[model samples]
Target chain A: MDKSLQKTEQEEIESKRKVYREAKEQTRKNARRLRFDESNPQPKKDSVDSPRKRFYRQRAHSNPFSDHRLDYPKSPESMDWSKYYPQYHDKESNNMLQDVEIADIGCGYGGLLINLSKEFPKTLCLGMEIRVQVTQYVEDRIIALREQNKSKDINYQNIAVIRGNAMKFLPNFFKKSQLSKMFFCFPDPHFKQRKHKARIITNTLLSEYAYALKVGGIIYTITDVEDLHNWMVEHLTEHPLFERLDKQWEDQDKCVEIMYNSTEEGQKVERNKGDKFIACFRRLPDPEI
Target chain B: MKHPYQNIVSTSTHLFVSVQNHLQAFDVEGNLVGSWKDTIGHEDLLKKQQLEKIEKLNQEPEIKRAENNKKVKIPKIPTPGPGAPTIYNYIRDLELTHDNKYLIGITDSDKSIIIFEINLNEDNCLKLIKRQTFPKRPCSISIADDNSTVIIGDKFGDVYKIPIIGENVPEKDLKPILGHVSLLTDVLITEHNGKQYILSSDRDEHIKVSNYPITYVVKHWLFGHDEFISSMVQFDFDRELLVTGGGDDYIYLWNWYGNKLLSKYPLRDLIEPLLDESHLPPERFLHEDSPKEISVVKMITMDKFVVVLFQKVNGLLVLEIKDETLHLVELFPLDYPLIDISAGGDKIFGLSEDKIITQFTFNGKLTIDDKEFKGMIENNPCEVQSKEEFYPLYTMNTLRKRSEH
Candidate 1:
């Protein structure tokens, strides 16, 4: 029995080392593929491939309060969206064809952006993720999809991903009432009593969301945690600028159906047979005092 | 032991200073008129009283032995270290109502807003009228122009509006009108063309100007600073010109109403010689050999000049505004570091690190005044026993964001 136990321990350590070696090899290959230099200025349309998710796995949670070093425009006017959407750039005018009207906050794995691209083909949709590796994965995934569908009519030119802390300075990247739809799908649920302030949805963050959304703009939220869902519902219902949409409104909305099944977290919940709760709120006109 | 006055406010008839947990008011002649102390040690006193009662009832000796045995079996949990969160019961922010009828202060111990009715004739000038507690500690306070509402910004990035004189509403009934996800540094309520607006700055280098009362309606954001804003003051001569300084290397002058950047006055050339080793970044970044940083501690405007103080620096920078531009006029050096400053009438009173008040007058040139309030107002004794018991004398640098996960 003692000999068998020793042999099993040795095997476990060997297996762990093998996993680490595989991850390191995958990282090297990914770096080589993403390198852009004078020799390889642009890749052939069919050569681009989707990045593997196993090579880009990161921790599920990130603290919203910490000052993560991020690159963001000083204001909406200073933001040059042409680089993010090169196909839509107008060379004569030195500007993009349209502004980003849809935002997916904490868009993990590019699942929802992929689904939303087809639903709102004309609208420019952007995903904002805080984690470094996760954001790069989404960018690679979008690039691969766009290259793969170059011959199709509905090319994936309208979707883009950026690394940003939306909680701190959403106004810095977008003008007043610039977004028509904002998604908060499966955000980090800071569960500690003292950490409730770090939760993505709160009374204060709602005001910023309201500022970015035009009148009648919709904010869609879904989560697997019932407690977080209740907290989001309570705060959104209390904010004067946001009015909760009823069940009938949720039933008729096509985006709600897409949101329920698109994200990676939602699929994980579906596999585990867990409950999913969704709430939608509409931005109201400012009151005259 | 010397205790620096953390806060000093001057009114027309009296001067008030907060030392540790004590708030003392003095008349123009430097006579201590009235005083108030925070209820800091009441919990310890109650625990002592309860233990004495238990000791008296346990004279049987059998119960005592059993208790001793249980104590021996269970080890006591160690006390938290310096980095742990501790409840400090001292005045964090103080402001006077527009009418000057009441003095408002927020206590850090209980997170309560205390209102005092100022009566000079009575022996006890400060009458504790109302004490209302909130969910978070209030970091900055501002009274509305109409004097009916009190706007408080807390460390949790929420701005709440409470009535100066109104019914005692429960804590649950109170709600914040606006908020930021980052920590709030300063909040101000200013008027343009008879319309009130709220200007709030956060640690994320954002200064939002929103419509007052209807605070849900955001007007615009002033977005030039790459560092957290530590202080913001409106130009006395031109309300449209907003002056802001913070953890950055420069101060910005803005035409807030028009959303234009008028000027950016760099401070590194002026303050680099004054930076010492103590001005280095917090311990986490020591390995990087990063350069020292400067944070603007306090700023006040007088006539056409703005008096600015940097954290732990033993000097003051006076800037003259010309053509909507900020030009450094003079740097008045001091013997000791300055803690806080207040402007009263034509005189500027500075509280230094040595626990004394230095007066300065600005006619055509800045000169020190001969008047002294050392023996009278600075003689009050505090109960601090050791260096660890004293509260922090400077906290503006803590507003700088750290690169941590």
Candidate 2:
């Protein structure tokens, strides 16, 4: 088993090395072309073409304007993590009950993740996104934040990003009573009238959230769409193992301040008084009956 | 043979002595062409704007009496519009689209800008057509002439040429144009003597001017600060001269082509009064007790004057350098820090620290026709500037490097 694990690690290393080489070479060519343009002004064309060739690799790889997408050519199958766990700095540091260790679901593009991490530096933060492109995006975001942390002592080891479906892989990864806080700031509303149930925050999903969170663990929901907000409230409020916090709790809740100021979504909502209704629910102990 | 601003001038300003024939062609939008620029009394700008609005609403003129304090909600206004820019904050850095058109903004929810074309169009129209998204956070963005390629500069020194093709697809290799190790604050495709150049500035005290293979380091060891270089701008009239504002509380004017040294404009005067009687941060401030945190310098204009809107004071200061002298002019003050400023034609637009735009003229008469803006006391009668940190416990060093680079 050890040997196989080593072999798998080596394969991962090789794959990343190849990707780095491609990125480096691409960087060099791009630098050259950019420099060329600086010296000689060139008229822009209609397309921001992607130069995808591995040094003249071909027309097949080229994206005329660079935004072309297609399915992965099989065996380029993306990696999946299940029954996976990371080495935490310490064990006594389980942040579930005492502090908020949040998992921002569907952290698209990443603005929300960045803001939340900064606002609640003490809160253990994790971002989950299913889109492979945006997952890599969160990776870069973590890297940049880590870079900016150099001059200040703001430690964000508490923060991380993982690629997986929160719905599919929650049980395989985190055991029950793990996360203290869960945020569904903004999800793909799937406003398609028929696909209304396809939305991320659902009653079944609330159960999943209940499973992952410890007793007293809180779930925070916010959305600009009134329909989605009502839907979220309806689902979570009806869940048996949950109870609502009071206005004082809402006001004194650090998470409330975090919610109010942290995300670009927060800023937009605040600006328009845009019905960005927020609701917080706490997980209750399972019924003895 | 020698000029004081030669040190920071990337392209010197062709200085303007007085106002010229102002074009009355357009006022921001082409349709709102009321009174473009017929050198009327200073009040004409806002007054004419109001009269035009009255005409648009077809409201009967009010009797000759006192103006009402009750204001109408001008939807196309100083209020939130459909084009109200959605700024993305990735903790430390900021990214705004070329315009709040399609996908107005994108950030990693942290400090990274991923490339996404929003229809971030700041237009009056509600329809949006966001064509594509890139996985890079470009700190600065500008479009090429054909509008096909948008040049995006990231804080990590990656410059990308994003193709604005109509469709978003997967097969394309999106990453292009990469260099530098620091965040780029602003970028401009400059034209000088029929030559083209890309001038980029960062938190570093240098403004890089390049034409690809040939790159000119306009201001290398700008000796002013020990902190980040926040921004740089050319005096509109000067093509070879430019000014840079940094955390060091000093604005620099450099000579672009000649790479000559220039004088420094210390910003101590503007905030010195505010910093009076202050509790000190670990860093140094002009006044003994003043908190020495790195105050950010926002926008600089070419007329040898920089308008700095800092956190402590959200007001505008006119930093002018004329005849080899530097002066700070206080145009007006805002309730909060000024984040961004944009000027087109003679009208000026400023965004406050609160993310709202206060649209008005930087230069206006004491009264708008009848309502007089009684000149504020340089030293207000009853109020005393506080000596405490405006934002207690909030460290400006949060913008500085923290650790894991």
Candidate 3:
């Protein structure tokens, strides 16, 4: 065979191998997209059978004005959290010895809790989302992850998600000084002047948060909205039981990285290239009068 | 048999009388001095009256000729069901300050309690000073002894201490001092050994006693009522003695501080006679085990007399307490069930379920005082026609003052 003929055949073989590799990468991308959120049923792309585009829209829910009914356990002691995180409890013993030490208020999509669970495997974490469907989705995601990693050493057994209005029932789930960390990632802004009270961070709510957290417990808050971020920082700074930690301290925290990268809202903000304001505060020890 | 008086509370010079939809003021002579109908109820009443007038006009031959003119219609208003908030909210309870200068009353409506400044010093000027509205409907209210703070217990079992002169207090500032686990039925601010405490009873049969002002520390739970604890009163003579009546057929007297049940007075036998078949709706009894649901609707306690009104019963039991023993001294029967009763100035006035106001005179005999009210006879008897002219402090003349109507 001539040299030119041999080189032409080799080039054809190389092009075919490149096509095969590109096809394999496309298949992997499809698999990852399929597993993004099974709870949110998405139809196949480029199909006329699916009428609704953007199936799971990301519109923030407004503040509940009237007839806001959220079920709450009678007391912190009365709540059977084992149902939310069954693996935490010993099946044979049927006893729950561990309590959730980290809580995410308004845990929309539960990105923070999932990420924090990896950083603090021994500490139990809970995400409380008021919206029923969002809570169910987060719960389903956790369940799926738990089942997927059943054989692996890394299982999501220490995290759980619950449907609850954290503002009204924070004390109902957490005993005094039970929580070490509380996360507030991208909460509803409630922008209107009349709706300022509906904001999650208030003087009264700060007292409640202080009661639930330990003396040195840290409150991790991040928001793309500057007004809400400022409102939270002002409230936490003004609160007698809390002292705002500077940006230097926040940069050193491991939870900050997971909080910025892990939450669904955080990822959305990253994709949009929005400015995120992060603030962390440590609950101060009670003053000896 | 005439205008029904459900609850009659008296000030120094006048009585704060509550009928079905109106809280009227009257002298001891039982004349309507001034009255304020619930604004909500007033709207309903006006609509009903207008409809009746239209109905009469429709029957007339002139209406047929002018049918085209009457084409413009009035929108139908929805009727309020049981426990529904209506325009004319019922006056659940009322209280007068120590000086009898301010009269505060809580209605059955959500988020509002009306306050009236009674200037009987100048004239029989009963002016609605303010409407203290909040996010939550107050189930029970107790005026502090100093008249500076009003303690309100909401249906959510949260107790809030509202300043009487809170002109511009924000809603967030009024956080709950203490909370119960269930719906609160009644709350009272009682003082013992110079320290004030809040005694609150709930539908869950739990009477929580908490330290007032600083109410986070729960003192005790006086828990004995089998069902919803509806009415509670602290003995005027003895601060420790508490009398509570509820869904149960008996009234329990408890030593609150000691957390001890002193006595349980059974009213089942006495209440049965008052429970005439006519009083109860025929449909209600068709269901199984309805008779046992008979509860004490109201309990009015005085120094020596205790008046107990049974649910679905027309008459009230007047028991005389002599040496810590209760004897059924009087059982005043009525054609209509008594809705509320209040005792003041040595007289008991019972408001029936309907528009009948019966006065059981000092000796337990029913007497009808003159229906007409003698006008306000004060040192400076000035008749103010409009609420705007009377309450100059408030610019908005809300249709709250019943006397204006």
B348 Cα displacement, candidate 3 (Å): 6.0
Task: Write candidate 1's Cα lDDT for B1-405 as tens digits.
Answer: 566678877775677788777888877567888889887543543454466456655654677868667432332234569898765567887788867778888887767788888898899799888887777878888888888878889888889988877666787687888889878899999889989989999888899998898887788899899889988898666799899999999989999888899999999988989989889987877767687899998898888888998999978899999998999898888877888887776777788656467777876457888877755445566745566766788887778777754
- What is the TM-score of each predicted model, taking all chains together? 0.87, 0.36, 0.60
DockQ of 1: 0.55
Error of 1 at A139 (Å): 2.0
| Clashing residue pairs, backbone N/CA/C < 3 A, model 1 | none
Lowest lDDT 10-residue stretch of candidate 2 chain A: A58-67
Report the TM-score of candidate 2, chain A only.
0.63
Candidate 2, residues A2-107: lDDT per residue as tens digits?
Answer: 9999999978876765675455445434433542243644423211232222222111111111112222111101222211112222236632323226788766
Q: What DockQ does every candidate get?
A: 0.55, 0.02, 0.03
Ranking by DockQ: 1, 3, 2
Query: What are the RMSDs of all candidates, in order?
Result: 6.2, 26.8, 16.3
In order of the candidates, what TM-score does chain B achieve? 0.87, 0.55, 0.73
Tens-digit lDDT string for candidate 1 (A204-281): 778888889999999999999999999999999988999999999999999999999999999999999999999999
Q: Which tens-of-lDDT digit does each residue in A29-119 have in candidate 3? A: 4434443444645433322121121222235774432223565665676687766666676667876778889999988887788788778
Off by over 4 Å in 3: A1-59, A62-71, A90-95, A151-153, A237-241, A284-289, B1-14, B19-23, B27-93, B98-101, B106-140, B152-338, B341-349, B358-405
Going through the candidates in the order shown, the clash numbers are 0, 78, 16
In the range B194-261, model 3's lDDT, one tens digit per residue, is 88888987765567777666564455566566567888876678888788887777788878878778
DockQ, model 3, C-alpha based: 0.03
